[model samples]
Target chain A: MRIKGYVFTLFFVLGVIQDSVDGRPLLLSLSRPHPDSAADFARWLVSQNSWGVLNTIASDLGGAPFGNVVSYSDGLPNKGSGIPYFYLTTLDPTASNALKDQRSSFTISEYPIGTCGKTDPENPTCAKITLTGKLKLLDGNSDEVEYARTALFSKHPEMKDWPKGHNFQIFKLEIEDIFMINWFGGPKPLTVKEYLHIEMNKVAFVV
Target chain B: MRIKGYVFTLFFVLGVIQDSVDGRPLLLSLSRPHPDSAADFARWLVSQNSWGVLNTIASDLGGAPFGNVVSYSDGLPNKGSGIPYFYLTTLDPTASNALKDQRSSFTISEYPIGTCGKTDPENPTCAKITLTGKLKLLDGNSDEVEYARTALFSKHPEMKDWPKGHNFQIFKLEIEDIFMINWFGGPKPLTVKEYLHIEMNKVAFVV
Candidate 1:
């Protein structure tokens, strides 16, 4: 009986300490970064989320903003680059749209990360980010493509086995503007340079 | 010892039967709808999800496609209207942008619903839907407003208590096009009429 009790206690402690859902590696914890820390919060949002809606200008739809659900990664676990990379094929409208007009935005929510708790997904405190920029296709031969593939495949392991005939190419968003709402007030002012250059290791997230 | 074993088995079976994570109500089971049942699948997707990325054309950002994370409800619990209604404020760019250009698209994924299992979010089988149409703000006095408010507040109770100073108004997507991908093939052939008119009760969901 004592041994069983010890095992259950250990499991409970581990669950509380880690507290990460969906098997995602923990960099950000149950409690998020301070909303005032705009750059840190923005970077943490991008780093922690593996997928978001990638929006693009659909020429066929009379220039309406077309949003598609997509999987993306900033970098390998814990070592996020703050630049979201995608594995896309021209067969999809988003990639085709990007080819015609690179203007795009990727939106991620804290709700799916399961840290939003009881707060509504739309609640400002739940944390949502939109990275607006050019969705550029990387040259297949470039060194960055290798990094991107490693980053994407590491997070979404099944991507490595995705059908090759679809001719998936690597794409990265060159973030020019950041719109993030993490608290009661409107968007926190964050510059692209500040978002990209923040030393992620120095951010000191409470785990 | 016999009673303890029975209790453990009961817990294990209950976990498998109702495998819903994140405290979301289980309407669609772990095994999702057939991709061939396009209307059923689409309605299931919308009814099962509480929030999604609402895309709008940002006139200020040189007509870039801007996607924002927002909470939305189609109707109440199992009684879904299929027309996604949102509680938005003009202070937000999405609402303001819609006032300028009603053209918009809302994207939702099966991933957040927790039914996709290990399938990569971007995987065709994981299921995603984008409803493109005009985002029209409902007349505050209309009977639909009552339905919309009830729908929105029931799914997202926090929305009712949001700051009245923000002037949150009810808006809904007048869906014109349905773009859904649920399997290996590209988007399923679904029309606005088919999606909205589908008798959700007739199409059986295995729960």
Candidate 2:
């Protein structure tokens, strides 16, 4: 019995260690809010994910909706403000497109956060959020830029080292609408005000 | 010496086993194509990923670009046709939006595939591709729907069991343009013709 117990503990520890090495969040990190808590669930999905698709109206493509995979931060770790900030370079079409037309959306999925285990990403229950509004570039000297830079660099450290010649600048989604699906029966009705005002204490991270 | 050798072998086996369990691809599975091979690299990105952000012109949202997390498959396993197929329900805005306007883009990233390896997902070297074109709903009785169903089901097994009342239907992206970035440079100039013709023999999966 002692030997069996020892073997079980060893395997458990190994599993946790391997999960960390693979960059997957353990169950403790995935403290999902109940689906009924629409605003909280939307905040949870955005805060947990590090990257998402940033869509823009591409003028070059005859006003087609162009989506690009990009990294973004809502805030630092557990202190997300429900507003997504992005570090974009004009060299990329997304930024350039946004310059031409500020209307855009940022979409993130819970699948990559490891909370929607075994569920297809497209599955209604898997949880996906789209923040729709104007994508505006912030003035470099603004205090919001400082906060956004900190939020972005903390999550994506490599951003600090990106070439200055590329002219990377801070851009944020001025969220006017929120479309989130954490369960069936269509997207939950979540207003931008409701999403932005959700207190952090209401939906605490388990880890 | 014999004890040390045994310990090393045990840990190595455990690591591999844990990686498999975690669903992170073993290093052997990540055979990246040279960044210079635009068509090959683009094809590999689409083939390896089972999900992406499918963007569409949202007529309801003042014609703003809307992106949604979606599961898609090009074909079964290693036999992708370079055209992505999706099983989406009109209950979702993405499918309904596509019906109103065909202009859309499907974007996928290398980050989720576990090959980016410590690189920020937004890092240019990490690779991201957006296939820009029309998102068309295929006829239920079309032969292409059969192929798409097989491809989508093989990748996302849970999709097969989704509620029938939701009315999931087949949709395919008629890729008119290919935008991919695999290295520290601007978008690779990959025409749709070049991307569609890249034979499987040229870029074989390592695993």
- Which number leads on DockQ? 1
TM-score of chain A of 2: 0.86
Candidate 2 chain B — worst ten consecutive residues by lDDT sum? B12-21
lDDT of 2 at A112: 73
Candidate 2's residue-wise lDDT over A1-207, tens digit each?
797656533432231111432254533443566687787678877876789999999899989999998999988876788899999999999999999899999999887776666667787888999999999999999999999999999988889999999999999999989999889888899899999897654443434
What is the TM-score of model 2 when looking only at chain B?
0.85
iRMS per model, in Å, is: 1.5, 2.1
Model 1 lDDT tens row, A40-156: 778878887889999999999888899999999998766688999999999999999999999999999988887777678899999999999999999999999999999999988
Clashing pairs in 1: none
Model 1 residue B44 CA deviation in Å: 0.5
Tell me the deviation in Å of residue A62 in model 2: 0.8
- Estimate TM-scores for all models: 0.87, 0.87
Candidate 1 residues B1-207, lDDT tens each?
797656533432232244444545544432345577788779878987888999999988888899999999988776788999999999999999999999999999989877776678999998999999999999999999999999999988978889999999999999989899999889999988888887654433344
